[model samples]
Target: MPVSKKLPQLFYGGDYNPEQWPEDVWLEDMRLMKQAGVNIVSVGIFSWAILQPNAENYDFGWLDRLMNLLADNGIMADLATATASPPAWLAQLHPESLPVDENGVRFSHGSRQHYCPNSKAFRHYGQGLVRRLAHRYKDHPALAMWHVNNEYGCHVSRCYCAECTVRFREWLQQRYGTVQELNARWGTNFWSQKYYAWDEIALPAKTPTFANPGQQLDYMRFMSDSLLDAYLGEYRILKQITPDVPVMTNFMGAFKPLDEFEWAKHMDVVTWDSYPEPTAGIPVAAAMQHDLMRSLRGGQPFILMEQVTSQVNWRQRNPLKRPGVMRLWSYQAIARGSDGVMFFQWRQSRAGAEKFHGAMVTHTGDENGRVYREVAQLGNELKRLQALVDTRIEAKVAILFDWHNWWALELDSKPSRDVLFLEQIGHYYKALFDAGIAVDFVQPHADLNKYRLVIAPALYLIGPGVSDNLEAYVQQGGTLLTTFFSGIVDENDRIHLGGYPAPLRKLLGLCVEEFDPMLPDQTNGLRVRGQGDLDGDYKCTLWADIIRLEGAEALASFTADFFAGSPAVTAHTFGQGKAYYVGTHAEDAFVAGMLRRILSDLGVQPPVMTPLGVEVSERRAEGRSYIFLLNHLDQPAEVQLPAAGFTDLISGRKLQGSVRLSANEVLILHKDTEHAV
Candidate 1:
């Protein structure tokens, strides 16, 4: 399902909190919103205290007024369950519901997200409020969607309270039938820590030494599912009351604590908040986040749920979104497969933890302000581009990102903590980003037949059926590019015997003899002497693998260390397909050149090749394509058009051969549109 379940038009606007203002200012806020071309606003995201002043009493008068006003003003509300924060009354009443840290200190309620996910008291009160909101707004004209809760597990991803302990025991009992089985699976025999009863089992918490790796892994799985259960508690109620309405919760991009892939399976449409630094200038990080969000739902067009109009107060140094930066980045969101453009707040808070956070209406409250003007400009452009709504970006390439591997690779007892999961994967993704290649961030189990090339980096843990899936994909003529630190362990964090990366040894056609974790400042030389476009000398970092080929032929080899001249990179043919393995991480020149060769071999061309600091992406309709050209440089840049001619949907100007974009400018060229002058 798309985010446009209720409205087919491009959804605009930001998080609206009329309760933050006086009754008199509500009308003025509405006027400002309309002036900004706002159509949709997420209401009541953090209004639990005002909605339900106490556990027993209900107060919908303010919300009722707000909903009515929005409906009257031609605005739709992404109504929240108001369960983001527990009320002060509930916290005061049930202190046990407060989350306890690993050190056994209970967090007191003053700020938001004070309750534990597994807390019975929290769910009881939270679900009760959700049911009432659903039934009340089931028929409201203003309700476009249901926002279940605001960023689940943001603050309290884990709890070490007594309540959690009991739940953990029960959860373990269900996962492993008896204590004997649990001990065997967790390898408790090693430290004379074998359990005799389920009640003896505890969460992987503070200890004199390192905790059991197996216990730590299961706890990670448990917490992710626990948070999911909490979300589904409210999600079920909303679906039961308003089955037609879509439900979503804004995801924190690439959040470490929670597994977003599993959560995405239960969502109606994916929506996430992105707060990229304006000082960074280039939107590389933001693009990866957008691709991950879109990939969560299999390339579905998602809403840009919340972004700051300018600067966010959370960072140590917050800077403004220089002039056209906001509008250019907004189009970047659209280009990467977002159907809607929105921000954290419609109106700036006069006083709160986020008062300094930028908004459409700034602290000065001037509609003519730079932020406000840019937001209105974006909204105005979005209104005319409704056709881009529900449009999808088709990519022939994908990058594998598994939270299981992410959790396992970075565990305390790893080869090198410096070999960060995101860093390794981000390195590969940056190559694709630089080449103007669209990519889907898929899990290993996802279907690979649709992709011409799949890049799997740092696959430290291989779950059941993943190797079989990869083998099948390769046998069916798919191209695979996987890296080192892969296929070493099972899902249980146990090393496979016989050889390093034993599972993938057959498919990858190679066996890793041993791997060296390089120092922070270490670099190994790589020489791809005869690998076509990759025939160059380059440096590798972070990891170096000494490989002995079984059936694979070396394409590139290490030129430094004792492992010099061994297979640093290899190519193996399986059935009708080819699998390329980089035994060690290579430099950007090598990665870019290798990707260029792989993409060129598969005939996957960029939407439009552009110079540095310029990004090109496309969204496809029935037979139409919207090519977005974004200039991220401080000076003007030009891009040669892939098509002969097209109409600039933004300025409605005819463009052909090549187009020039001013510094921090964007142009959405509509391919084969009748408006082509």
Candidate 2:
């Protein structure tokens, strides 16, 4: 089933906290929302304290009236369970409900997510709240979808309290089944830390030096599973009552602590909050996040759950979005496989922690303000472009973005501190993005037959079945690209025995005996062979592998350092396909040049040729291809269209030749011969 079957059009509007406002103001809010074309609003996201004022007292009358008002105004509700935070009384009555910090200090109830995930009282109360809300709103006319506990693990991801320690032991017991297995898996014999019983295992906290690597890695896994357990507790209750409505919680894009891919499997719909800093000016990292979120559910379209309308309040010096930039970013999300565009709040707060956050209705409650006008215009545009809903973005290139690798690669002690996983992934993703090539992020074991090229950057941890998958893909005529520090360890962070990059050594046709890690100030050069974009010498940094070429030929060799004249880059012909290994972190120019050469050799082309600042993306649905061309520059730019004329769905303009797009403008194009405008 789709995320929201009842409301198929692009879900507009955002979080609406009517509980914070007076009854009269709520009526005005509804009127303004209707004027702004808002059809859905997420309510009661953090209203737990108000919903049940005291432990024994229940007060959902205000919410009941608010729901009725929303239904009467033709607005749907993405109803929240009000279990994101427990009432203050719960913490006051049971102190164990509060989370304890790494230093062993218990956190108070001032902030949200203050409760411990494994606390018995907190889970009992939170699940009870979900049960009550689900039963009451199971048949409500305004209910579109269920918004579970808000942003799980936004804070208090892991608690060092005694209760969590006990629960962590239980979790370990369930996983290992015996103490001997635990000892072997954790490699506890190295430090005389072998456990005699399950109770001996403790939370990794406040050690003199670094904790046991295996223990720490398992703790990370347990903590992620602990949060998932809390979510599942509420999910079970909601599904038992209202099985038809899809349940979702907003995910922070590229969040480090929790394993989002594992969480995505439990969620009925994948949604995330996007708050790119205005100073960055829509960096490639932000685009990568959109692609990552979309890839979480196997390339399904995700919802842009929360974005600020103008400025955010949390930053030190908040900067407003430049004119036309908000609209441009919204379309950017749509082009990247977002089915809905929403924001953090519907109305600006008069007084609260988020008073300065941008919203659709300002504190003055002016519906005709610039922010409201833009929101309304975008809402109208979504209505016009309803055909784009449920569409999928097809890509011939896939990039592997595994969180297990992310967690293990950044451990306390590794080969190099400067070896960052996302930075390496971004280097490759940015090159493809700048080349105007659309790409999809995939898990390590996902099917690779659909894409002609696959890029797995810094794949430090090779779990079970991943090696076989990559080998098969390469052997079956799929070009593969991997970088330094890949295939170095298993899921347990133990080194593969034979050599560096052990499992992939055969596929890559190279063996590394040692790693030449350089400091931040150090640099090396690579001498490229043959005549192309990669013909000249290029700068490399961070790491260089001491390579012994087995069967592959060197495309480039290090021109400096002790590993000079070694294979800095190698290519091997395996079966009908080729595998390339980059032995060092190179500059952006080198990465782009290498990508261009590979893509050219593979006969892969960009969707359209555009300028550097112009972004090109395509979505296909019902035998129609929708091409989005966005100009992200300060000045107007021109794009040459294909010979076959196309129609702009936004402006209903038919054009055959070159088209000029204004600064921060967007065009949704479809073949002119297919549809009449």
Candidate 3:
């Protein structure tokens, strides 16, 4: 389900904790919310303690009044299950609910997410509360969407307690079936750690030197699944009681612990929280995260569930968002593929852990504040652009972002500790972003037919059928780009044996004899062979695969070190498609130049040409497209419009030639005459 049927426009507003203040303050909140054009408020997210003050007693009196007040004010409620953090009493009554760290020390109460996901007692009380809340609020007119536990596995992703140990073994048994297969997969024979029985297998905790790599990978999977089970426990109950409400949980963007792709399968709609540091200044990392969340459901529009209006409180030194940064970032979210834009709070707290966190209504209790004004302006813009709701972003290029590969590649025993997964992905993503090209993030197992070009950056782990899928895709005339250290290991973190990049060696027509892992300060030069923009030498760093071309032609060669004049990059024509492999991590300029050449050959072009610091994105709906132009700089920038005259949705002005946008400005252009405008 999408957001509730009643919210036809963009769902706005955010976390509102009325129980944190006096009763009279709620009326003022409603008044200010309407002034700020707030249409929805996520309430009761952290209200478990107040809602059920004791084990046997429950209170719906205040919630009933709050719901009625919200409906009367024409605001919808993204009603939360309030199961994120259990009550202090529950932890006191059942200490087993607490999570124990890898060091085997149990965490105490006071902080949030202290409960162990696999604890039976915790699940019982948590699901019980969810059932009560669901039944009580099922028919409430203000209920819009069901916000499941807030940011699952945020603080405590794993527990080394005995309960988790038992659950982990059961999970392993279910996956591998027998102790013999477990030993084979985990490679237990290496350190004489072979287990004769299922009970002998231990959780991959702090070992003498290092835990088995395969065991560590499996434990990550188990922890993700265990937390997912906890979310599903409440989800099943909520669906059983209020089947109409759409259930969702906020994901921390680019979070590594949980496999969000698997979790997205169970979510009614995808949503995530974004909190980028201001110093980064609109980095490509944040854009990649937005596209990643959009790709979770195959290009479906997701929600901007939680963003700070200004600065975050958790960072060591929280800096305020410069004048228009909040609005710029909010539009960036929508431009990528967000249907709704919401913040982490409606009002700033007077006292709490998040007292300093930015909010729509600050502690000064004035609607005339700069943050409030910017919030109201964006709200009004969203109200005007209601036709853009439910639209989707289309991309001809996709980058594979796999969580399994991320975990395996980051393990302790990798060739180069400097080889970071997301950094590698960011390199490719930034190339495309700077070129004004639209791109989608995809899973390695997702269908490759939709994209003309697929780039897999350091795809270190190739799971079952991925090699075959890529082979088929390449043989059927698709272009693929992958970097060094890819296809080196299987899903079990076991080497593919014959050579590096084992499975893809045949497709790429190359064999890597060995890897040359470079230190941080080391560097090499890559001399381009053919013409075009990549005809010069470029600096290569981090890693270099000693490659020997089989059926592929060398496009570049190492110009330094003992492997000088060796193949550093190669391209092969397989059937009707082409595959290119970069055996070394080259500089950004080389990657961009090579990508531009490849994209040109594949007939892929950006929607519009733009100057640096200006971002362009498009969303399509009802046969019409809306082109978003945003300036991320402190100075004015100009963008040439398409030959066809278009109307600016924000300014309601028709433009034909080049238009200049002021610093931190945004424009939504509708191509020619459009529908539902």
List pairs with backbone clashes in candidate 2: none
Clash counts per candidate, in order, are 0, 0, 0
lDDT of 1 by residue, 304-421 (tens): 8999888999888998878888888888888999889889898889998999998888888888877888888888878888778788999999999999999999999778888788
Clashing pairs in 3: none
lDDT of 3 by residue, 603-642 (tens): 9988888998899999987698999999999999989998
lDDT tens digits, residue span 228-312, model 2: 9988998888888998899888998998888999999988889999999976864578789999999899889999999988999
Point to the candidate with the largest lDDT.
3
Give the clash count for model 3: 0
Candidate 2 has an lDDT of: 0.88
What TM-score fits each model?
A: 0.98, 0.98, 0.99
Candidate 2, which segments miss by more than 4 Å at Cα?
A: 675-677
All models: lDDT?
A: 0.88, 0.88, 0.90
Q: Give all candidate RMSDs, comma-separated.
A: 1.5, 1.3, 1.0
Off by over 4 Å in 3: none
